[model samples]
Target: MFISFEGIDGSGKSTQLSLLRDVLEAKGHSVITIREPGATLLSESIREILLSNKQTITSTAELLLFSSARTQLVEMIIEPALRDGKYILCDRYVDSTTAYQGYGRQLNMEHVELCNKIATRGVMPHVTFFIDVAYEQAQQRMQFTPGSAEPDRMERSGREFFERVREGYLAIAKSDPQRFVVIDGHRNREEIHADIVAYL
Candidate 1:
């Protein structure tokens, strides 16, 4: 089974993803956890460019660079791993592009969808968990976290942009309810993990 986790930054999705991976591995499943924009050498380079605060990248350029990184990840890592019948647990996937570029950046949604198709080449998760966290809480987590000494460019997108991205995530989930399992992000880690495992 292929699964993907989606949420805005500091939504606790990564924590949940890690917990899930551990649980699945304990159950004798071959869980392959991967983060987008960093699975391949080229993708990791693109990730640095995307997150760096030094250079000012245009909105269109940002979208294309992300697409390029995703394309490389899908072709080079994701597809082959799935062919080997491993359970892939991805930190983020196509929905992120839609939420960030399309909604947060106010880009064209239709164009964003098209770009995602080209980038992913039709590969999608069997199930996607959209961890629903309030924008205010997510922002607070980002700000107060110890390792977050310097906020990345995307993290500095501010409250309004993140609110829009949150809404975008909900809309995407609403449109594909079957493929998406929306979980409350406010709950305790163990509780949240229990809910997610129940779904599986």
Candidate 2:
């Protein structure tokens, strides 16, 4: 099964994902974890370009770049792993494109959808977890983290953008309830992990 976790920058999706990966591994499942715009040489290169605040990239260009990375990842890593019967656990996936590019960037959703379909070549997650956390709370967490990593291009996009992205995620989940498992991210780490495991 292909499982994906999604949310805003500081929404704890990564934390929950790590815990779930450990649990699944302990249960004797062959789990392979991957982060979007990464997990392959070419994809990592694309990730650097996407995250670099130093560069000025157009919205359409950004969308295409992300799709390029996704295409590389799916063809080189994701598809092969699935063929080998490994369970894939992804930190983010196509839904992120729809949220960040379509909603956050206010791009055309139809174009974003087309790019995503081309990127993954019809490879869809069996289940997706959308960690629900308020934008202010998430921002506070990022601000308070000790030695926090420098904010990326998207992370620095401001509160209003993230709010739109959050709404986008909720809308996507509402439209596809069967594929999406929405979890409250305000809870403790263990609690969130338990909720995800319940779905698995």
What residue pairs are clashing in model 1? none
Q: Where is model 2 more than 4 Å wrong at Cα?
A: none
Clashes of 1: 0
TM-score of each: 0.97, 0.97
In terms of lDDT, model 1 sits at 0.91
The candidate scoring highest on lDDT is 2
Q: For residues 13-67, what per-residue lDDT tens digits would candidate 1 score against the true structure? A: 8889999999989999998888987788999999999999999999999999999
For model 2, residues 44-103, the per-residue Cα lDDT tens digits are 999999999888999999999999999999999899999999989999999999999999
197 Cα displacement, candidate 2 (Å): 0.7
Residue 188 miss distance in model 1 (angstroms): 1.2
**What root-mean-square deviation over C-alphas does model 2 reach?**
0.9
**What RMSD, rounded to one decimal, does every model reach?**
1.0, 0.9
